[model samples]
Target chain A: MSGCDQCALAGVLPPAPTADPGRPRLIAIVGPPNSGKSTLFNRLTGLRQKVANYPGVTVEKRLGRARLEDGHEVALVDLPGIYSLSPRSEDEQVAHDVLAGTMPDFPRPDAVLLILDSTNLGRHLMLAAPILALGLPTMIVLNMADDLRKRGGEVDAESLTKQLGAPVVLASAAQDQGLEPVWRFLTECGAAPSPVDLPALQDVPRCHAWAARLGRHAAYQPPAPPIWTRRLDSILLHALWGPVIFCLVVVVVFQSIFSWARPLMNGVQWLIAWSGAWVGSLVPNTWARSLLVDGVWTGVGSVLVFLPQILLLFLFIGILEDSGYLARAALIADRTMARVGLQGKSFIPLLSAYACAVPAVLATRTIENQRDRIATILVAPFMTCAARLPVYTLIIAAFLPERPVLGPLLGTRAAAMLGLYALGFLAAFATARVLKSSILKSERTPFVLEMPPYRRPTLASLGLRLLDRAKIFLRRAGTVILAMAVVLWIVAHLPLSAGKVPPIERSLAGTLGRTVEPVIRPLGFNWKIGVGLITSLAAREVIVGTLGTIYGMEPDAKSRGLQAALRSDLTPGGAVALLVFFAFAMQCMSTIAVVRRETGSWKWPLVQFSYMTTLAWCGAFLANRIVTALA
Target chain B: MQANVIRRRAPASLAELRKGEQGILDRLDLPEDVSRRLMELGFVPGSPVVAALSAPGGDPRVFRVDGSEIALRHDTAVRLKLRPAASAAAN
Candidate 1:
């Protein structure tokens, strides 16, 4: 306790909370978007954090437990970043509600960790006014202390603390420096101080002025803007080269996630198969063995195959986002997004949609406007994701010939794949336009975004983010996907005769496929393809694995080999229809589940599902007719 | 909103300020919420703003104000009335 110093704040503070053993003290971590609140939270909690939604909102709440230096445990609720107390979006509403103790299932925070960037205190400091108005025990965490000192910025923490009637500490979550004060603040005697005069909650200029005056009185020296930021922004935001370079970047990211991820995907696939076969060899010809290998292993493995790609995608997103190039990309995309009735912020999320719509939907939280966010969510699935890649590759390779479409420049197989991508992109763009002009209509949302200076991304932050994403993916695989696989295996093998599983035609799965065959026959699909379509509702890419199993079950399909099996089974028109159908169908249960969670209700996801499925069916029917006539 | 109520003779909107020029914000001529957000970002009256650069599409222009770079589209930036940096400094 030699380092403990409370001489200046002795009488001004109350004893810290968490003295009660039953209910741990809850401290709200609040800050602007770029304040390093998350970094601080990650540091304080380490791996103790769990992210869940705040009851029924689209924004997620991150709750983590941390232990103080004196061995007292406390819970930290990290709130979404907001500039002020006045709520404009769901993110702000969550923050405001949590602070006011009005949010359902959330306790009024015992204390507030007000994090602000020390280098940009003039602008970041305005958030202090309304927060202080909450009259809660608060400590101003001046984060990015290293950046502050490096940039020649300085502040007198004692003077600022006295001015605000709260204790202040300077720390850097990135460098992991000056965190000793944080541990002391939480564990030591710090309580709700006497209320100090602050500007009205809605009075922006007054708040700004008050914060500025306090900074000056505290001897705060603002850091000079970096010279390189301007130099970089010149070419990065240039009219011609900027857009060209942005295109190249988009192409590179797209290619890397698709092509560079191939070997890793193959590795994951091989591991799953080898383990499944090895485990299966130990079990006899019982249902348990079939269930173990075919149901759980194959089902989870299909989803897990995309893990490498997802991690790679998140790695790129984290780097681009943390290093601040995503903002520039968003600005460059604003004009094109405007054409589709969205804005710049929707660009990165939509680009990420091509990698996977699940993260893309989560990314929409960055857009401040509710209408725009919902609109983005609705259209995100129309961007063909990595889940659809295997289905596309299998079909295109088997059904289409490799004849050149434009001499040697383009092949028919490649052209078909590009067409599918373009089809999905057009559907997304058109749907967004329709949605904004109708249900999601709103007045103009001001696109006022702060351009943070580009900095090198930390390995810790990116690695931790990828770890979180991987956990979420694995959790999905272990739960819903694993269960679905088990159920599917039972359904396909049910109504056994003489205590033995029947053939694919006599089994329940065959009857199930046959029953739906008539409905899809007009689109040129048979019972085999119908089975693939039905099972793929678990996830789109499951169709590839299911088709492999389906043919393995039927007698004639096993002889022609797999690729030849598809070539013999599907007609030219049927193959094109299938491609068109997959392009528009909302077949992935995970995407639907994510949509439901993000939109806060079944209403939006149901509407999206019904509309997309209808479009897909109609599209498939039309493609079948047009192709059959051309042939 | 009083952000639009002219207390002083503010000359030009921020949109009209060319790149490489500086100006002092006179007031925000926007709705209450919008102006409030801008002011919180250091668009407060009497703060110096320099037109830093234009985006590739040339709609959302970036500006340096209060030691931070912020981007605002034409519709939002047009609402920010400013006094020429030369005139404000001379005054």
Candidate 2:
């Protein structure tokens, strides 16, 4: 294609039909958040196809090959969850744009599957009619059928089909039921003709005419809630008790991170140390011993220490999301979020960023608005990630001496960890406000979200999600972080001289650090510290490992790693200065790459990096200067 | 409740209206804060509301008002005054 033609193609606009074509078979799935579009997508696709990104976009589109029972192959694409066809967020736009073919690149599906909740069919069909107006083949999937069983509700699918001018298949994607019937209908015949059964497109009594033609479709009744659920929800969403209950639940979740995961964390640490010792005994003076013990063991092993905690965190979050309590939590926070020009959905990504930003940025795919996604990305880096844990733990241990609290009832170590995490969060909230008003001045999309019903979380699925996260971390360690650490180690440890020249001073790292030392000196860091910051370009955790090796505190250095070495090696003020430096630093090159990919441009990533680096330098400098003066 | 009660039992709230149920809103009994917010969302007392989709559990009912679609808590939905069409009322 010519450049101009390519440009036009890239900006393809959605097609709006002026007249209705004979109703094509379009099945559209419409429901509230957590209503299981993704689960349904998985059922329909069933490991048949891969989830891939759109040609040039970070938004994931699931494509699968579906074979009809009669044996016709059909290509299926699962659109992102959307409240309506009217686009407010980037995610919603992708869905709307694809359906409308507003974008030249996105092809409109021949059939649309309108998924509805069996318990909430009344509200779900509002989006259905609009899709019907598109004059495409359509059917409605009444998802979450299992919920109705527990709640004492039943939908008359056959009667609803006659009333809707299309077939209604009651399926529970979570439990794998009624899926084939829906798929068979989609592949076989298209949507039924637009009947006079349902309401028309107008604002007035079209419902009356529609209902009259379609008898009994509206007469079905919802099952009553199970006693257990009723009792749970009473307190879960209670006006006065709900907030207290929710807070208690959150506290329990965090406490599990420190308490419940201790055994597993200890096991991981033991394994790392044992393996390191075994290798050290084998390779005596060889570089292999250093690589296995000091490099791999101390660097990557430290990260693995918290895997149990991370998994537990994901487990709790996944369950909360599956159970529909997340929506209630959002509803509770909605008023507060609205005040900040953010919506309830923003909380999901912000909270996820605490564990790490990679998946959290990807999770923004759920937020239908583009402006909102971009704003969320800019603020996500401020949330203290798991990688920062080791750094924070070391600093808090050294500077904030444990003290008795609550009249000696509380453990001081636990309190210190909590305080450090709190400080990171406070910084994040302040940064979010500043960035929301200044650099990222996008209009805040209104928070209009559907709160789906509660359901038991499937352990199989939750385990799979946790495994996926672990795999991602491992991949980063092996490729980005591992390579960066080795390269940094080589630069900082090469060609030692007997009092002739310093190892780092004559090496690449030292030269670069010296170049930047003048600029960074005001931040209370020497040339060696400046070099550590530069080498940490791969990830935040790399800074500590790099400093450990550079300061002769590597596992092989006859001293425990960096934190212990730092206490003896530097003045207390210098140690504090280093802690402050890591607090504000944007040292993760991988995070920067993901931000660029998500934003679809280099501008935002550069802005994020520059602002964060500048802040890190200033914060470190001020802390260092004040500490020295006080001493 | 009255002779002119539109549709089945004169849907006392928007939640009572089934999907595809279209009606001219009669009145709102919502508290002042909620009613103001509803109006901001284009669900003014007289504006037509077409019940769209009910969520999985069905408490927050999605409705289309003006050109926008929004979800409302089912309890809050019950306070929205609505008049069903004469024909559907006849059904």
Candidate 3:
């Protein structure tokens, strides 16, 4: 393996993937939770990383090509952070599997970079015993060297290296300091190192004793944790002030997404319309021109218009998560969750579900209890995701006015949006209570969460996350929504009478919509609304795009905005029912597929879909009945 | 399920410790796997534990062990048996 030096010197030759035949030398980046592993991975790999899932599982597989200074390109995988090799949850199971070279598609690591936070070496050292036992060439990268130094913590790296029989490097990955040793280790440790005596992690008590003794022999002094965390916790986790502060945070996040993103969303909408007009002007107004302007532009643009709102949502969510505040919120929400038979850990996933259910379902991997995880996964889609924002915003803006209900702080529109969000949250809780008490019953798992020290989230990291999220959003708009739009346009114009387009009611798409209309008409939806619901099954946001394409094909609808076009066609009662339906319905195929893969069967997703759709039907019917009566 | 723990002997557990109080962890009176996890997190026997601020309803409380704050709910924390130490650490 050390012959990579010759491979490098073969002058402009591609670094041999000699280690794994086709794959580069695989090095697993292992760490304890919040051990600055990601910070280090990001620094080393920069943006060369590809984020994907392990084959058939929702667990993320983050692989990146890290160019060693010696011109050797190695593949670095960021394994799920775990306390030990003994698996406790699916996340730990995957990490353990990958490290053991049992995980499919991921080859055995030729070497390992074990990252442990330097400031908390006493406890973090427990990971070393299991990782070291694997007998791979390893480097103990003690991350957060700066924090340890600033807090007057001390560790004898020479003594530590001697005790652990592994090279130890003190590094502050964020500050780009003490990293030369890391580069040297990568090149130098190409050959397997001498195996050291290691305690099996399965004997947890013995393992801890071994780590504790090693720490003492190394003279590892745990850093003084920041004083401000306790001080802040006194107020932030206050009996009275905490809940109030949490509510205030949610409101502020909600209000800002609307007010801050309005101008941006409008800018996007204007750009989309301008481009459509520009493209339309150049080409003669034929069916091909219509396909480009009305079909592709309208369909994709309608979905694309919500990108600003989605970005803003992630911006706020990323801030909360990275700043360590979300951990506190989990603690706060635990009490509320308990009534529904879940713990605080479930709250984090449920909260993340508000952004999107896919990752939120993935997040349930942290929950140790199987029943609790299933319950959380099932209720995830009920937390109104960013995709639903397009539909909610369009309807609420058109139906509800801009007048403030709670003075200038809360507009009628924002209040209406909040009401819809609350509606989804309530439905989630009610469903969870039923599921927990009925079939998915289990004892409440121990809630043990490490409260990470609060740090100001860096803009570079936040910006990177936002960019990643934007890519996902735009990719969906380009692919699914674009294909659906084009297909819908063709269907709406089918059975061309005398080589001419027929009215929408006589077209294939319209006939299909009309067929489904009777079933949904009880909820006050027309055939167009029926069409939107049918397409929304692809993704929650596709309804907005479907409507955009549908109206774009109509002559009168072409003259006005989407919301304006919607208002003329839908009654206030129908609008409320549409909102309620989306709030409870499982509209995303991706989420269902993930549920299937995660549960390892279609049974749970089938039950979840049936249950949620039934709930949606009932809730939408009630809303329609009430709203129409009131109107 | 430990009968001795259910008998409620006099020794205080983490669930009973007040803010600013300190204790030494004796043994984890929990299921083997749960206790194993607790030990791995530096809650091993003879280690120091300092009480920290808790949540709003005070069910899940933060305890400082090995220079880190960990929030454990009463259901689990109550099972952490304590061996009283000589001096209480000043908060």
In terms of DockQ, which candidate is strongest? 1
lDDT of every model, 2 decimals: 0.83, 0.63, 0.79
Ranking by DockQ: 1, 3, 2
- Worst lDDT run of 10 residues, candidate 1 chain A, spans A1-10
Q: iRMS for all predictions? A: 1.5, 9.8, 1.7
How close to the true structure is residue A535 of candidate 3, measured as C-alpha lDDT?
69
TM-score to native of every candidate shown: 0.92, 0.73, 0.84
lDDT (Cα, tens digit) per residue for candidate 1, span A430-527? 99999999999865557877788888899888988898888877887788778888878887888897888877667787888999999999998999
The local distance difference test score of model 2 is: 0.63
Q: Any residue pairs clashing in model 3, and if so which?
A: none
DockQ comparisons of all candidates to the true complex: 0.59, 0.10, 0.58
- Which scores higher on DockQ, 1 or 2? 1
Q: Give the TM-score (vs. native) of candidate 3.
A: 0.84
Candidate 3 docks with a DockQ of: 0.58
Error of 2 at A539 (Å): 3.3
